[model samples]
Target: MAATAPSQSAPLAALSSTATELDVRDMVEALGAALTDAGIDGDLRGSITLAVSEALNNVTEHGYAGRAPGEVHMVVDLLADRVLVTLSDSGHGMPGGALPPGLLPDSSGARADLPEGGFGWFLIHKLCLDLSHTRHAGRNTLRMTFPRYLAPEKS
Candidate 1:
């Protein structure tokens, strides 16, 4: 089958942080600028922003919560029709180094018992074309790929 998106051959782009909320914000801004600099279209920009934000939030809140200072590293690879984001944190890994199987966020359920708005993973799964996670040697890594044309062009 023919590919829907253009090809990519760009070099990798990277950012490092301490996994704090402020640092995550800085990284997000920097990455957004990087995407625009690479000629990313607007709609895809929004998706990438949301996905990256949620991912970073998870890293700070879950992976590194209450831990000693450590680094959260992110690398971006921009291709003609896609972007790949790899985020790594030197914090406690998930049990057995595996991401919990992604679930449909319970946000839509009418069940009163389900807590509201734990929607980061759900948004990440829906917005990104691909998502994967791993942990080894005490570092957790999340890699997400997003298609360039997910956003419609501005009229």
Candidate 2:
């Protein structure tokens, strides 16, 4: 389905789909396009894409593990000074219903012994200015925001 149209005072984009790798990729791509259309690019755009992609991947892989894929809803808003993104799902909540501390995994071990995973949340935290998660009534909601980003002024 097409993404929702943006309004000056409303969300820049909104989309919903089953939580799957393909769908998550599509959502991320759509979001990137929306950000580009809104004159957002470079590092800020990269961070938003990475964080949102990781969150959606987690929902598909962990939240819906052993069950049918669940629905994931995403809304993005580009304010004058920041970008706000909210993702929600009716799948399993985070362990203990709390956000992960997002500490970087230990990398002092041998190359082969290094972690092959566990960096998603860390990267998300590092890129976002703020992050939050909540679970209530069997739904999980994740909210993240990034600092100002706008296309460079044309000469």
Which one is best on TM-score? 2
Candidate lDDT values, in order: 0.79, 0.86
Model 2 misplaced regions, further than 4 Å: 1-8, 150-155
**Residue 44 in model 2: shift from native, Å?**
0.9
* Candidate 1 residue pairs in backbone clash: none
Best by lDDT: 2
User: CA shift at 142, candidate 1, in angstroms?
Assistant: 1.3
lDDT of 1 by residue, 1-155 (tens): 66545334444568898888998999999988888887784778888888899899888888877876578999898766677899998887765667655566655556786766577777787787878888777678888888866662222
Residue 48's lDDT within candidate 2 is 84
If scored against the real structure, what TM-score would every candidate get? Answer: 0.79, 0.88
All-Cα superposition RMSD per candidate: 6.0, 5.9
**Which 10 residues in a row give candidate 1 its minimum summed lDDT?**
3-12
TM-score of 2: 0.88
Q: Return the lDDT, model 2, position 111.
A: 94
Clashes of 1: 0
Across 1-155, the per-residue lDDT of candidate 2 in tens digits comes to 66655444678899999999998999999999998898888877887898889889999999999999989999998776888899999999888779878788999999999998899988888777888998889999999888665421222
